[model samples]
Target: MWAVRRASHPLRSQGYRLGAFRAASTKSSFGHDVDCGVVVTCVPGRKVHVLDCHSLPLLSAARHGKSVNGGYCLWNRGLSSQAGTESSGEESELDDGFSELENPIADTNLEAKAGEGEIGEGLVSDSELLSDDDNEDDAGENELHLSDAESEESKKKTLSEFLKVIVAAPRMKMDAALDKWIEEGNPLGRYEIHSAMLNLRKRRWFGKALELSEYSESHKLLDFVERDYASRLDLIAKVKGLQKAERYVEKIPESFRGEIIYRTLLANCVVQMNMKKAEEVFNKMRDMDLQMTAFSCNQLLLLYKRLDKKKIADVLLFMEKENLKPTLFTYKLLIDTKGQSNDISGMEQLFETMKAEGMKPDIQVQSKLAKYYIHGGLNEKAEAVLKELEGDNLKVNRGACRALLPLYADLGKADEAEKVWKVCESDPRLAECVAAIEAWGKLGKIKKAEGVFEKMIESWKKGVSSRHYTSLLKVYANHKLLAKGKDLAKRMVDSGCRIGPWTWDALVKLYVDAGEVEKADSILQKAAQQGQTKPLFSSYMTIMDQYAKRGDVHNAEKIFLRLRQSGYVGRIRQYQSLLQAYVSAKAPAYGFRDRMKADNVFPNKAVAAQLAQVDAFRKSALSDLLD
Candidate 1:
């Protein structure tokens, strides 16, 4: 065994750095104030291995003892290397496929609460380690008393907290924050890492996700699970394109290339409408005997259902030959195909066939059936199906309710939509509530829309996301309920709901509709003050267009300047708006045109034609003066 002593110079001081790993520490995972460290051992002749004192060496049998896929109990000991403290049998390993120098703490306290009896009854969990404000007792309560269910909950909470921290911080701070998290002995294991990746994907932040993955690998923690491959492939497809994604899949190790990755790629192809590439991938899957499920086959069927319906029959035949059993999803795809081709009878036959197979039709199937009948103008058939769904002993799902609301809204059946809304009102999902509100809004039933928004807000505090708040603001704006809208906006801000571009536009439009130009300008100014560095281009354009139409060239110019200050410049539309302002103000057009030319923005037909009219007027005035 190599007994390595600390070098005279610290690693952090020696400029030792890796992916997202830098030297900064308030407290190490061991509660010691030391920075992260690694010990390098040089073997005879050629090989050197860097190891963490707290971490087992890569080739060490202890390293393989802790599998990344296995779950471990919480760590009880602190990370301090104080004398007289021994590694406990209860000490858990990092199952995230990472072993780093552990911050070892001295034996402190190990008293469980009134009803705790697990082996790890006094350990600190990954969640506790991550929490900054958590007291010693709070940490103990979480780690010691957690049952299996609570342990799962703790893991989810830990994952959520980690994501929030990374998301809230600036990109520059992300590296330091992540390093600190790992150094604190929190598990950045497979599940946690995948959770983080999914959240990033939801935000379309694939670049950041890839950065995190690189950091994980540098820390020796990256586990290439099937989901991870699929997520990365999807990110590649989105960030690059379908062609790049195809190329990427080809480069993946043959063993790692499987159904999930193929499904993701085929899905991407369907989305991009690259039918030729889709066919190639499908054929490749078939040739490799990898197309074992109807899932992959259905994706291709979806593509053909949109383009060439004749090919869909061939796909169904291929499914039979492959012995890939048709799933409920398969029938759903077939139903959609027939519906698209206006084959109402064929759609009905598929739906009945699905039910005859003992597959209880879910809300999705019911909704599709209703929609098919509705599209065929068979109103009675649509009503019968909807009535059966709503009155069935089986609970009407939010989707079914959602479908009925839109149909009712389209037909101006406010009472019917209200019935559907009542069924969906108990749903915690904001989408269901938003759909009900929109249905009312579509029918010009302002009171009903307001009632839907209010009821949802009152029912579930978590239901009212920023989108819901924006939707309510839009309702108020549309109805010119100025006082109500202002009150709601203030409440929304006070509740700490983020105001997006749509909300900003709605607020501005409300004031503008009330003929309060200065008030609209006031709200825009307030948004800018609140750190809205970049308002929507459309929001700024709306105000400028309104000001120009009113011959308020001064205010229009102010909005134009605001857009430019917000880092939007050299756009033809912006220059055209400013040019229109000059025309309305009856100022010289030549100066504005020259400015446009300087910005390399030539006038479009509309602006050129207006300028031509202005030039003719100027010439006539000069000629009359000379006469």
Candidate 2:
């Protein structure tokens, strides 16, 4: 046996290194002369070089025999030295030259494992990891001068740049970026494909996310794992709604129909409020005999909690029968259901049960308790719960702070509200800002509310939403800070904010308080003409109520007529106000009740008493005229 290595070759410079080969004189089955040297072919990214034992013998001979698979054994040190691979973190070991160049042992082992049915679990095909070399020769035969390390570094740079472009590119340019990636002829590595999809998903660019997923599948770049499917399902639910999510599930073959897919479908059902569909999914899982896990049961329980709390008993019984252990989330959900039903005792029992089960209540549970206490008007209990929550940690949760703020506002506990605000003020969320502002505004702390507004403007990355602007405007409107209120209203309009009904009512109240009825009427008229958004019925009601209280019944009737013309059928309260206006003016309102009835609006007790008073007064006036 002889081992041969070529010292110099034109092909070596072209990125192709031919390893040593062996020759034997044994006759073969075909009965031809058997003295030709075996060829060891080495193919790089493109070109291939074939080495013959007789032509190149630059190294010493080594022991040789038939390989395990009955092929002549030959070794290649150069190919063995390479640790480069297509997948991130996975190293591909080069086989001896005796193995076929196209058939690496890594691939063979992967195939063997797949045949044993472990493919989808974690196994990825080499074809997906490595670039397709079947069409390599057809792809122009250019010699790549980059060494292994240099090639890896270049690839890392390319991936990094590609990720940056994808992330920073506008939604409109995402497709172009993907096309550029393909045009660059750089094979996308595993990390590149996964990271790109993840980034697209995070941006909620559903179309681009699906496009990248399809691109990967079409190009055989990476196999779609469970996470990929989950993300795609999430995109479908978010962008295309529940129907599309259902269709997506149908398209998935039965092999991929597992607990993960069902869980995603159930979550979408929850979001879409399709309770029946959620139940159907649970039934399907049972039909498939999929193991009833606590997670699946919990999802089902959430659906039940929203729709019919009585069904929660069924879930508990099912869990007991199935021997599925209940998680902390399950117990917490039960606690919430009890709290919502006002069964405070039941809720407390569940809390005790959770603790007995070694499920410690976290900040979320404490906040829930605080909310329950607030709902029941147990202010002291609510305060105690909040204090316990605060003592638990110096760094309070934003949600907890929001909950505490609202409770403080409702109870008129401004100092406690301020303390909660201070804890979350350093790094506040939009919700936290809104809650703090509202709490201070309710407590009649206009200055503190304004301070929070300024902080909200300065800190939130996305500028304040119209709702935030309107929230602050309410403070200005309530306090009759006419100068500031007028300026802010102009800013809101100039900034293209649709003034909320509360803000509009506040402004009208400010005008009425100032005895500027004409200005208030003009504001309403301007709001009506400004946009397709008609002023809310309450805006007109505010002005009518103001006019009625001032005994300006004619103006009140005019506003009422305008409201009816604007497609607002008067409700009981509005009708009562109108009737009160008639009583103030002593106008005959004989057919008004009939008209209200025609609109399916019945007069309340207050309107009835007003009508009776009018009737008795008319009878008395007639009697006097007869005398």
Candidate 3:
């Protein structure tokens, strides 16, 4: 659409300037200078024309057909040029007509006719201009004003060419081509390349494009296409290309750098394993004088976690120096990382800091702190954290409940553990609590752990299968309740829960712990018959330890030989147990003596000396009994 702005004129009627000009005669009956109002035609097709209507004497003389004035042509020469048909004959005819004019009215009519002819000629020229076919030779010469359809077609052509370049170029070359197009000073080219880059990003080639942009920045070519630099950084981050994303951001003009870009790039770098790059970018950001937001500061905290504790301290010092306040996410990350590293002091300090900052710990943070306390064997602190979060209603997590319940059982805090379990019972995540309860029961919190099992059964409603029953059996075996563990195993099998090697191993370990060798042997036989004795290292160690504890030299020797034959490397403790058993029997054979004397053999020197005392005592007892 063409926009027309009207120009204002002061001397004209209704603020409208007439398109015509007039010239006035200066002297009476003599050639003199004329006062002329010159009107220059501003529109492209028309020409300047002057009218001398105000010269009264000349007007009077021109009223008659004869020219009483000197050298005056009635018709405007400018009109002939406007009509596109300038000729000497037309000028002569105008002069003859001026001689024939009867009055000024005839001259006005003639001027009006010339004006109409000029407009008609302009219309004809425009039609011819539009009709001319485009050719290579005429293309530069013709300044044809584009119609809306033609402009749209040009835009489409530009966009199509740009898309072809983008699609044909490798990902690494796309940004270079885009930057080159933008540098060529074509707005359409800039828009097209920008659009193509956006599409490439959508197709999951954002990383490659980001790399190209970085290369462009290094070459000082990125300045041409920095309009959407922030958005490109965000896109690179969303696609998880942190390094390239950071490079794209570093190339962004200083005026364009803002909190959003800084935070996104910092967060991206925070999770990467490359600490050196992250630190460098972070420091560079600081040097840029950009105020780090809370999110960005938190990202630094996460980045510091992968470094040493001293480095973390340095980061904290830096944060303090920069006046960056730690947010809830920051504290949460610090607490979780410290907890994972078993840094109880560090976790406690972080918790205290949060309290000082008046930031109430959320459930996720509380869960982490509780887990840390539990790991340190500080059940009281763990329970306190849980209870604080749960409050009067005791709304602890099922997993936390399971974890804490076991700790309570170990500490004999059965009531507290039971309360936590009740809260867990109402939660839909009951199955998740099963492992926790079993863990607690195994840690000698049998009764408290049993409470969780009973809740699971009640929640399930129907008779529980062996799959469910085995967890409780495992708890029993863990607490050295061999008899109960075996009975539960049998019940589990009868209830159609297939007993695996783990179940048998648990039972055998429990029996071995209880010194029920005969029962353990029977269970082993049954396990072998069922093909459930998988000869696990721990189970073998348990049986061998049981033989050593009972002072059964012959059986211990037999088991040791069996273990070696079965590819078991007999540990020193097992060998010591054999020595004790032989000394207790008072019948140490030559082979057994030599094996015991072998240095660096099963039992070391210290254990061998202990075994010699046992042998001496056995000999004295035998002599006493004989006397």
Candidate 4:
């Protein structure tokens, strides 16, 4: 990555510094591929102007003349730099919101470029994507605890020179990128580093982002404040694991160990589904006498919404006792939890209460309401919510396309889905394109889905990342187009796209659907071994379900063990699948009750039914061998 060396011209003194970089697909030593995107500048006497580095105007500056404090060159953050786009560290990984410009999808840099697009297309002035990636209040994970003014200044940081070199390769060594950036005489303002890291994290390049943060830490690149420390802890949790993050926390100054820092740890614990640890961290926060934050409480709500429903009320009680007002995410969790339990009335009451308290529902809330309505067989209510979501202009609301596509598909409204697709097609983004593919696939239009996927390749060209490929791969997997799925997988490998969890899940399904269960198992095991990415919990369950169907008792047992070893310990689906495998083999599920008990998994009626079937065959210890 050849850093665009210092612009030696006197224009540098005039504060009209120039920089150029290309964004493209590239591989890195960091164990994943990345696409770069960042170009925000504050010119002399102009409101902060930010445009994508890959925009036509920016690329023009890179190739030809270089003098765009306004149009052609990068601007220096002199006395008047404004807050650029900030992708704050996220606490909850759930999809609970959407809107006209924001998608609740796996939006990476390869997709829409940032969380909840706060700036308009082409050129944005004064508008700031100050929103972090959090589902709760925008307090986000960085918990940098910097004063608001300090954070605003940090948001102004934008790296102009290095991205040019970054365009030359898919990815590079983190140290190498940073070293080259410094060698070229780029200013390592703390916030500019934040901007670069924000761009990288928005693109889902966690590995590279962590390397940059680590470099900043070791080099003392910026003021090592609580925010930087907290942000790095969150990154370490993402790139390495909880253990590494905790170890790093040990080295922090005792004074710097604040609420934001421990809350960051609690968030990661919830993400890993480590219930015991999550509770311990929550209690630790109380023990520290830190004022409980809605963000931290929301993290628990997210975890309980996934694991155990009964515990949700207890959290609500705690919130009431603490006089904590529910955040948007808190309401979202309660509404969703209520809806999933088929408690439609309760869901409505919670949503109404949210509005009664003047908490306006955004596109995300409406989309979710429509989703639950459709799921609960209330098509009229769902349509009413959908129509309300479209508001006054379906044509203008591009963000609704993603939420609408699947909701319409589930309702069997192909015509409606096509209408949503039309709005996106007029000027498609990567997120919209991916949604169209999934929607078409769901509607059983493989040809249309394939056509959408191809057009995506044509539009983005080399801008496509492995993250985008997962959507279409899933379409193929769902359709049982094994050959097509295999070909796509090969293309992904050949193009050197990052193979993360979603792709791994799709690959497993591809072989599983085609009766190559063993092959699917191997793919999952290998992905786990590489340790570059964590496999999704669903990916493991997919293989186990197939093994049970085939009476592959031993394989089912093996996968259940693997799942536990990987820290996916509390799910009951694995237990059910293992019991089914034994029943299919006409053999006893030895110690099945004890196994569930150990995992803290209590049997529901369905699980109890499976247990009864398996227990009937519990003849003797020798019966563990065969029927």
Candidate 5:
């Protein structure tokens, strides 16, 4: 009966046929009862199959063969080859069956474990099947699903496509989309999208990308965009592309508006001289109840200086109403603009008002005030500012001293100018005193100028620099003191100062003026040996003209030939001057008279016309002798 039931069981029908039956006393090493039916399949060769006997009553009956002629026959002759043919499929089926059974068992075990917690009963735990380390290994297996090369290539392709989009798209559209993408959590979109937007801003797209990025919290996008915005705004303003910047500013929502954006828009409008638009923006800022910074107000004042004074007065009145104290920059703009317009009385009143507000005039304001006084013919007032500045602990700036020195010199107040020069000379930072010395030279106060130059040289030797020496050399050259200029030039070279083309030209001209051709020649030769070809034609002409002027026709001709040999093509006047020198320096009887006659034969008009006039008079007197 058990054999018959086993043969008819589902396991046998699926080819896991049983061949024998055992009682419950039989057991296997894995702790399952061996009292299951053993299902056997007979083909050319014999194979055995086992099943749990308790779950297969029908297979048990088939194996026992109570309804068949065989004794405990559990074998099927055709089943063996079929089982072999379907081994894989049947194995999978068996695996699914085992897994299905095990899953319930596992759930029961879990429930039992949970029940153990409630009832304090001991149960086998999942820790027996696997350790935490094995769990980690399973995680590692999951991660291995994607290889490194595949992941990396996918990332690169994504980034490349993103960059292509950014590079090809219009800047405004790209920026807008970038803002939207960043807001949507910066997902699998290319990192280069943000980077490309940043690059566009760097290429001087100014506020476009930055305005989009401002409201984003992505640190990377904000950082790159702000850095690019700051870099390009100045250049954008310089090109008068402030409208593009204004377009960016207009996109900034009220909640995201800040001092930087406001300042940028205000500056752009000012630079474009779109004062009406600037005022509208400024008024919008005020209506927004944003605290206006001192810089913003100053920018408005600058725009007003160019646009409408009434608007400036209106802004000032608004400041008063807002209880905002006018800053130093506010006063500076008003003072400077008023001074430029020659509004002396108005500037005086404004200056007094600034002082009353406890804001002392800064150096810039004082400089403008000095200029105002000087221009209005109030030299005494300008001098008073200088004297007052001198007594104050505040360092009198070089610009202020420069303005004062010329005024004193122009007023013929040499004593005061000399005093100012003394103060400037003693101060190391006020090396612009050389400018005053040069001015004194221009005013033809050569002795005072020489005195200042001597002081400058002494100061320079003690601790000053080639800058001072260069300035003094220029001053000496301006005064036409060729000997002093040449001496200073040597001092500059000996001091290890680089003899730049300007310095070398000045020295060469000085030497040429002093008829020191040999010294100039030595300098040029040294420069050539050093492979420094500068002051090219100017230096050549200096020597040529000097010799021609001194009537040294021999040296002048030598210089002219050397210039031509040296590839100088520009000095036709020098050549003509040298020719005239040749005519002038000849012997009165033979060389001078014959040279005069030969001058007419050379048909070059510039030379021929000049020589023909000279020869005409000479020949008229000497026609009798020649005939």
Candidate 6:
């Protein structure tokens, strides 16, 4: 093990916005001087493997560079992108598979008060962040500016005392506690204040993080750097809406308003899938002559890949014009996009090109290729990839076990999945156990899945997180094992599992899949009432689609309306689900076309087909004549 050493290097010396509290003499709220020592977490070659998503390193680029996917990326389907946090045990696994890192906020006293729902509701309101009228320059007092260099908060508190102060009351704004901490003779260590904000963000507590940031800025706490500015910008975009973030951006001193700041904004737009805004930001970056990096290009690619695969070629053409060499991530996006379109030949060609360019396919890429091949009915190719992924020794290459299990199960190779599971069954990691449960669930082995979960509970050193529980919850959801799902959910509650959007999404799937759509809808409503965070967009989609499929137009319409009210107004899934509900119910959806146009959403072929089928259940004059 590498021994911890002193990083006595000054914060400003290292170019970080280390704040005014960086002095070693800072006292804690307890009135004791603390060691403002860095943990020296500069471990080389360390990789944070994401266990799951309501978790990117998060599906943060959501299917694309969706929001914070901010941890070190594991091989995502396309390419691994940059993320900085490790996964906490408490995350609920989202459907999208990406690699995440372990939670890095170790042994810190960043505790959350029970039932207060410290994190903000997930994916709230991406609705037009800035309207045509809320012009950029007009944002008034909400603007972000640099803090005063000698802010008093920085003078009073120690790092240890500061963490306790902020986390002591997670539900309320941190401003008062900070004031109280200062009043108590605590010297704010720049390290403590910054670490507190970083930990809160990792915990997915965007509102609290924003509150802390606001406090830091309003009190003139630290001399802000460009990265510090970018971090705050991300927090604002997440908490206050993108428009507010943009408005705040207008006040940023022009010197610091470089590509990183614009790129941060660009990412938020992509997360919300605001293609128009994303493009505008990109164009602005171009106009400013800011240097373009793989990140911005990847962001555009992710957006177009999801919204209009047709526009992907245009993004590629632009990249080519700029002479941008594709990174592994860029290739990952292109290959996945191609595979998704069922252009297997194109996908293969791109894979070859990546090889020709000397970018080796890592495990994640090979895993992704297996997925495409399996989906494409190229079982032989998939098997080859899986075998290659496993390599010679199962123990040495146990990391591939998680990826291999699901892919094998998807191929219906129960024995092969068992073979992979056997390798790790003796001493499995949390991720491996979760994967085994999913693989077994897919293979229809409920007992085996349960058995593994039981074993995981007994063996997992950190205790089974709600994230760990989420894997089995998904299995139960997939098999429509309502009773089992309910039992496990109760077990989770009894075990005091921290519920977030991920768990909420799983519960919705459980109820909806088991023919308990109303119950699922009820859970969602109740969750909305309790959690500071909104439910996932997919959660809304779950209920809406089920309602539509059941021909429950009233409920479907209500959910569709609720979805819009919840700030997920931009997604086409709800619109389609609502239209499909009308069609299924044999009801004419009058003026639906106008509604679509109003929202800037147009009908795709599937939605149009649905519309044609439901457009006139009543005989219109033209249709009557044709008949």
* TM-score-best of 1 and 4: 4
Report the error of model 1 at residue 485, Å: 12
**Lowest summed-lDDT stretch of 10 residues in model 1?**
67-76
Candidate 3 ranges beyond 4 A from true positions: 1-398, 427-468, 474-487, 509-515, 528-535, 565-567, 586-627
Of 1 and 2, the candidate ahead on TM-score is 2
lDDT for position 396 in model 4:
71
Q: In model 4, where is the ten-residue run with the lowest total lDDT?
A: 74-83
For residue 556, what is the lDDT in candidate 5? 77
Best by lDDT: 6
**lDDT, candidate 3, 33-120, per-residue tens:** 2111122232333322221212211111111111111111111111211111221122210121112110111112222332232211
lDDT of 5 by residue, 181-215 (tens): 55665332213433333344334343453433442
lDDT of each: 0.55, 0.55, 0.47, 0.61, 0.47, 0.62
- TM-score, each model? 0.51, 0.52, 0.34, 0.72, 0.36, 0.72
Q: Model 6: per-residue lDDT, tens digit, 313-423?
A: 334434433546667766776666545544455567667767767889887778878887887889999899899999999779888998999999999999999999999
Between candidates 3 and 4, the one scoring higher on TM-score is: 4
Cα error of candidate 4 at position 171, Å: 9.6
Query: What lDDT is obtained when candidate 2 is compared to the true structure?
Result: 0.55
Each model's Cα RMSD: 24.7, 30.1, 42.4, 21.4, 46.2, 17.8
Show the colliding residue pairs in model 2: none
Q: Residue 244 in candidate 5 has what lDDT?
A: 63
Question: Native-vs-model 3 lDDT?
Answer: 0.47
lDDT by residue (tens digit), candidate 2, 150-249: 6657655766787776676675456677677778875565656654544454344556666666666666765665545655676566566778888988
Count of clashing pairs, candidate 4:
13
Q: Which regions of candidate 4 fall more than 4 Å away from where they truly are?
A: 1-158, 163-185, 616-627
**Mind giving the per-residue lDDT tens digits that candidate 1 earns over 1-627?**
111111222222222221111122111222221211111111122211111112211111111111011000000011111111121111111111011111111012212211222112111111111122221222454559767677768876998889887787676447788888888987776557655765664454666776676576567675554545665676667566777888878777778898767777876676554555776676666556674566666666555433333234334434443445566666665555445434566567667666766788876677667766776777788888888777663244445665577667766678888777766666535667777777887788888788878888888686476768878787777778899889998999898887876688888878887778678888787887676335666567667777877767788888988876764554555666666677777776556666766654444445565566545345676788998
